[model samples]
Structures are given as structure tokens and as C-alpha cells.
Target: MYYGSVGGNATFLLNLPPDKRGLIHENDRARLSELGEAIRNTFRTNLAEGSSAQASGTMSGHQVDSIFDGNPDTYWCPEEGTEQVTIEVDLKAETEFNLVVLQEHRYSQRIEKLELEVQQDGEWKPLWIGTVVGYKRICWFDKVTSRYIRFKITESRWCPRISVFEVFCG
Candidate 1:
């Protein structure tokens, strides 16, 4: 019975008290973890291929479009007095994305925490909440639609500024 069960590629091992039912051993648990990883990798997809980004406020020389200019040195810094800033991205066409990549100014810790939202049916819905992100942050969540991606900065370390180099959705 052990030989047949061990090599049968079974996903679940039943444990019963009446007949000393088999309990999944280390090998079986390892196999299950591998299976789960394979499933996640198989369906992962990037949905933010050609989206355009926009911001709520910009500084004197730092414009909102700087984040998408494909230059690391150029970044978008929010205007003063706008304590809470937002950066919204228009996906052009509706799509599904489960990952968000935020690239901050090389070594700045200005952005301490932020929230991500998506537009659905003309209303904005919360998607993900990011915290303790210094330079770069990759946020992952269950697949959601990408009509309008909004990144709101709620907490900051200093300067009341929202500085970001690039933001990617996938």
C-alpha cells in the first residue's frame, strides 16, 4: 500500500484513526508545495503593458510625465502644500493586472507608505496597500481590472513630497 500510494502522484493523503490512515510525510508535503508553486507560475501574467501615467501635482521643474520618460535621473516630485498626493495611470484599454512595481528616486526614503486603487464602473476601489517601501517596491495581489490605476501617498518620512522615478503595472 505504501509503495502504490508513494509513487501514484497523489495530491492528498487521508489520515484516519480506524485503520491508522496514512499521514502525509515530509516527501508528500514537499511535493504539494511544488505543485502549488507550479500553479501560481503558470497563470501569472503582466497586464500593464502600454499604460500611460499621470500625477496629481508636480513641482516647478519636476512634471508629472517625468515618471514615464524612461529616464531614471528624471523623476516626478509633488508640489509643496499637497501633503497627500496621487499618481493615476490610465491603461488606455481595460485590462487585468495583479502586480505593481514602484521605482522611487535612487536612495530617497520620502515615500513611507502608499495605497493603490483601481477604477471600476466609474468608481474607485481599493486594490493594495504598500508600506515601508524605500527605493523600489513590487506589490502583488489577486488579479484585478486596470481601468485607472491610482497611487496615493498617505505617509511620508519628510518634505511632504511624492517623488517617484517610475511606476509599472503588471
Candidate 2:
């Protein structure tokens, strides 16, 4: 079953209960398919609208930083051959901030031990870490109160190619 509304646009997929499945006529599959399509279209529309607003620059740089794609040069994965991009954000006087890193792993090999780091006291410190498996698009979000921020791709068995990096302040 699926359900959604514009203001609280949400969709859920669930397996039919055994009793319900047994009761459904073969022809009912067509109606289920139609409902699935409608819910998917609604989600697509909402996503497109949100993306459009961010691209239009109506959103503040800080608020929309998660959606911003920084220069490609700012990323470094072993397969990318020494290409590393670093962004430094000053959080002076700010109580909180977030860093969003988007990466695409397209190689057949998987990446292991992905991590993000922040600069503290002139040293790099780990903030978060994870693993990337197969052809996955990884979005990493880190929230901190430090005065400086940066990202570190700690480990990769294949290659880590990032599509974008953005920092937001709050």
C-alpha cells in the first residue's frame, strides 16, 4: 500500500497480508500498479520543485549548501589519482554547522571505511565514517560546533568520486 499528500508528501510500500493477497483478484494487480505510479509521480514532482527552488538561488547559501555541488577538483579518491578537493568553513561565532558530502562510486569494486574529518586545533579529527558498497551514491552529513570544517575520505578499496561538497551554518 502507498499513501501521500503534498504538504506531508510521504509514500510507503508494503507487502500484502496473506489473507489480503489471497482475496485479491488477478485483475486488481492493474489497479495496484496504477496507484504505485501515481504515488511515485507525486514524489518526483515534489523533489523537482525543491531542487528548482535551490537552483534558482532563492535559498540562502548556508541553508542550501547541502544541495550545492562544489567544483569536482575538491574530491579525492584513490582511483581518481591524487585529485583531492578541500573546503574550509569558518564556524566562528556560529553555534552549529553541517557539512554534506555527495559521492558516486561507479567502479565494480566497492569502497571500505569511508570517513569525514574536521579541523580542530590545527589538526584533523574524524567526525563520521561508513562503508560504500557497489554502485552507490553516498550522501554524508556531519554536524558540529567546531570553528573549522573539512572532509577526509579515509579509505577506499576501489575509488571514491565525489559529485559535490557543501557546508551549511546555523
Candidate 3:
């Protein structure tokens, strides 16, 4: 609910009903706490944070390596008019992740279609495909361990600019 709500540009609200004594039910309180812990555990660390990033094309001043620097101000943009480009991330070690979160620069053109791939046995295999990445897109796939993964922008209104590229398990 948290990811789906935020990813779709909405706020999530969970209404808790209290007992006749005006105290929140223990079951409800416990469940809510569990939900909070689950979310925290899933996103506690980004598997790709501070790792190496490479792209097929890049515009001046927007280096691909800045994607995981934890800064939203900077972004990676492809060369002018480059419709199709691929961004690859090196986690430095085989790590398992099932979720990919991508956020576009605030002012860049929207990405229409993007695909995720993982390298296995020297071959790149497709994992997930997404569309309409207006501001953020979350692709959830089966958990897999890999040292390398890549995101390809197949269609965009213009050159796609990515401000945040994150990978996680959950």
C-alpha cells in the first residue's frame, strides 16, 4: 500500500478504530507496527547506492555515475535527441533485489517505455518492462542475485533523464 500509493502520487492513510474504552485495539496497533517495520526493513538500504553507473549516452554535466549519489538535484540525461539508451549499474558484488525504483529529473521529458535486464552467465535477460515514468516508476520482479543490471529507455517524449535509480529487496 505504501509503495503503490506513493508511486502513484497519492498519500496512504490507514484508519484505526478504537475500542469502547477509547484505546486503539491491540491487534490493530500490532499490525500497524508490523507494517511500518516491513517497510523500513525493505528499504533500509539501497543495494545500488554509491556503486558504479554507466550509460550508453550522456549529456554534458549530467553524468551517469550520479544516479545513486543520493542527490535528487543532479540527474543523468542522454545526448540530445537520443531516444534509445541503456543505463547499467554495477553493484560490485552479487546481490539480490526484486524492486527497481526510478525517478526522473523534475524538468526532463517523460519516459514512455523502459525495460530492465539482468546479466546472467554472460547473457542479458529481460526482467521487467515499464511505461509512463512521469516522475517515478517502480518495477517489481522475482528476487534475483546479480552483480550487474541495466535499464534501457526504449521510448520517451525526449531524452530521458533519471535522477534516482534504486534497487532493493522486498
Residue 102 displacement in candidate 3 (angstroms): 0.9
Across residues 1-170, which tens digit of lDDT does each residue of candidate 3 receive? 77676554345777777799999999999998998899789878898886898898899999998788888899889888888999889999999999988888885547888899999988999999877665666788899989999899999876888888889998
State model 3's lDDT: 0.85
What's the CA error at residue 76 for candidate 2, in Å?
A: 6.6
Q: How close is candidate 1 to the true structure, as a TM-score?
A: 0.64
By lDDT, the best candidate is: 3
**Residue-wise lDDT of candidate 1 within 11-60, one digit each (tens)?**
23645233335555666677668866864564354344455677777788
Off by over 4 Å in 2: 1-95, 98-101, 105-110, 133-143, 166-170
RMSD of each: 11.4, 11.4, 2.5
Per-model TM values vs. the true structure: 0.64, 0.39, 0.85
Model 1: lDDT of residue 75 = 73
TM-score of 3: 0.85
The order by descending lDDT is 3, 1, 2
Give the alpha carbon lDDT tens digit for every residue of 40-78 in model 2: 553332111112111111112223233233343333233
